[model samples]
Target: MNLRPLRPTDLARLVELNDAAYPAVPITPPEEMTALLGQADFTFGVVDETDSLLGFLIGLRPGADYASENYRYFDSRGADFLYVDRIVIDATVRGAGLGRMLYDAVFALARDEARAEIDCEVNLDPPNPQSLAFHDRLGFRRVGEQETKNGTVTVALLAALL
Candidate 1:
C-alpha cells in the first residue's frame, strides 16, 4: 500500500468510504469537503498499487475554525493538540494495517508539531467496539464523553499523549 496527500479527485470516493464506515458522522457534501480539505492540517489517503484509494484520514490542528462540536471542545480547552476529525477505510481493507499507517502518520505529525496530545472521539451511542479497542491498543484513553448533534449522538472523547 501507498500513502499520499489527498487530491481533489479523491473526494467522491472518500465520501463513499466515509458513508460506509461512519454513517453516524455527519455527511459532508462535495463543496464542504473541498473546503475541509483546504482547512485540514493533514489530509491523506492510503492507496493500492494502482493508486485506488483504500482509506483516508483528515485531522485538524488546534484552533481550526471549522465547527465540529468535538473539535471546538478540544479547542476550548486551551491545549495544543492534533485532532483527528475523521478516518475511514474501505471494508475490503479493514485488517490490512491501513488504519495503523494513517495513525502513525498522525502521531508523527503530533510529535513534529510539539503538540501535547492526539485527540479523537469514538461513537458510544452507536457503539463501535472495534474502534474502541483499536484506540485502546494505540494507548488512547477516554477522557470524557459528550452528546452532540443536539443529543442525537454521543461520543467518547479519547486522547493519546504525544
Candidate 2:
C-alpha cells in the first residue's frame, strides 16, 4: 500500500469512509473539508496501490486551543506541534493495520516539521470506545475530559511527545 496526500478526487471517498467509521457522529461536510484541505497543514489519507483510500488524519498547527466545553488547553510546544482534528479508517479495512500506517505518517510529518508533540481528542460515547483504546495503544496518555453539543462527553485530550 502507498500513502499520499488527499487529492481533490479523493474527497467523496473520504466522506464515505469518515461517515462509515463515525456513524453516530456526523462527519465533516465537504465544504468544511475543502476549506481544511486548503490550509496545507493537514495530512489527508492512506491509500493502496489501486488508489483505494484506507484511512486519513487531519490536524492543525497547535497553540492555545479550546475544548468542546470552552475550556482552554495550552501547549508551549510552539508552532511545530499539531492538533489532530480527526482520524478515520474504512470499516472494510479495519483489521489491516492501516490506522497505524496513517498515524506513523502523521508522526513522520511532525518530526519532519520539528514538532514537539502530537495531540488529539477522543469522543467518550460507548460506541466510540475503539478510539480511546486505539489512542492508548499508540502511547498517548489521557489529559482530561469534556462534553459536546449532544451531551456526549469527550475525553478532553491526549498527547504523545514526538
Candidate 3:
C-alpha cells in the first residue's frame, strides 16, 4: 500500500468509503467535500498496488475557515493544533495498519508545523467502541464533549499532544 494526496477525481470512491463508515462520521455531499478540500491543511488517500483507494484522511489546522463544531471544540480551547476532521477506511481493509499509516503522516505534519496537538472527536451517542479504543491507544484523551445535530449525536472531544 502507498499513501498520496487525495484529489477531486478520488471523491466518488472516497465518499463511498466515508458513507460506508456511517454515523461513525456524517455522510458528506460532494460539494461539501470539495469545499473541505479547499480548506484542508492536509488530505490524503491510502491506496493499494492497483491504485484502489483503501482509505483517506482530512485534517484542518487552527485558524482554518471551517465551521465544523468538532473543529471549534479545539478552537474554543485556544489550542494550537491540527484537527482530524474525518478518517475513513474501506471495510475491505479495516483491520490492517493503513489507519496508522495515515495517522502517522498527519502526526508528522503536526510536529513539523509546530502544532501543540492533534485534535478530533469520536461518536458517543451511538457509541463507536472500536473507534474510541483506537483513539485511546493513540494517546488521545477526552478533553470535552458536546451534543450536536439537535442532540441526536454526542461526540467525545479528543486530542493527543504532538
Candidate 4:
C-alpha cells in the first residue's frame, strides 16, 4: 500500500470511508472538507497500487482556531497535543495494518513537533470495542470521558505520551 498526503480528489472516497467506519461522527460536506484539507495540521491517505483509496486520517494541532468539542476539550486543558480528529479504513482492507501506518505517521509528526502527546477519542455510548482494543494495543490510555450531542453520545478521550 502507498501512503501519501490527501488530495482534493480523495475527499469523496474519504467521506465514504468515514461514514462506513464511523457513522456516529458528524458527516463533513465536500466544501467543508475542502476547507479543512488546507487548515488541518495533517491529512493523509493509504492507497492501493492502482491509487484507489483504502483509508485516510485527519489531525489537528493544539490551539487551532477551530471548533470540535473534543478538540476544544484538549485545548481547554492546556495540553500540547496532536489531536487525531478521525481515521477511517475501508472495511475490505481492515486488519491490513493501514491504520497502524497512519498512526505511526502521526506519531512521527507529533515527535517532530515536540508535542507532549497524541490525543483521540473513541465511541463509548454506542460502543466500539474493536476500536477500544486497538487503541489499547497501541499504548493509548483513557484519560477522560464526556457526553456530547446533548448527552446522546459519550466518548472516551484517550492519549499516548510521546
Superposed on all Cα atoms, the candidates' RMSDs to the truth, in angstroms, are 1.1, 3.1, 0.9, 1.3
**What TM-score does each of the candidates earn?**
0.96, 0.82, 0.97, 0.94
lDDT of each: 0.88, 0.71, 0.89, 0.87
lDDT of 3 by residue, 40-144 (tens): 879889999999999999998778778887797788788998899999999888889888889999998888889899999999998999999998998999999
Best by TM-score: 3
Ranking by lDDT: 3, 1, 4, 2
Across 1-162, the per-residue lDDT of candidate 2 in tens digits comes to 778888999888877877776643457688866766666367768888888888887666754333423223524433346777778887788868887888888888889889877787776653567877888899887766666666755454678787
Give the per-residue Cα lDDT of candidate 2 at 20: 79
Shift of residue 15 alpha carbon in model 4, Å: 1.2
Q: Considering TM-score, where higher is better, how would the candidates rank from best to worst?
A: 3, 1, 4, 2
Name the weakest run of 10 consecutive residues (lDDT summed) in model 1.
Answer: 18-27
Q: Please give the lDDT score at residue 113 for candidate 2.
A: 88
lDDT by residue (tens digit), candidate 1, 1-162: 988999989989977887777654568778888888999988879999999999999999887888899998888888789999998889988988999999999998888889999999999988888889999999999988999988988999999987
How far residue 84's Cα lies from its native spot in candidate 3, in Å, is 0.1
- After superposition, candidate 4 runs with Cα above 4 Å error: none
lDDT tens digits, residues 39-69, model 4?
Answer: 8889879999999999888999888987778
Q: With candidate 1 superimposed using the best TM-score fit, by how many Å does residue 90's alpha carbon deviate from the native? A: 0.2
Clashing residue pairs, candidate 2?
A: 144-156, 145-156
**TM-score of structure candidate 1:** 0.96
TM-score of 3: 0.97
Runs off by more than 4 Å, candidate 1: none
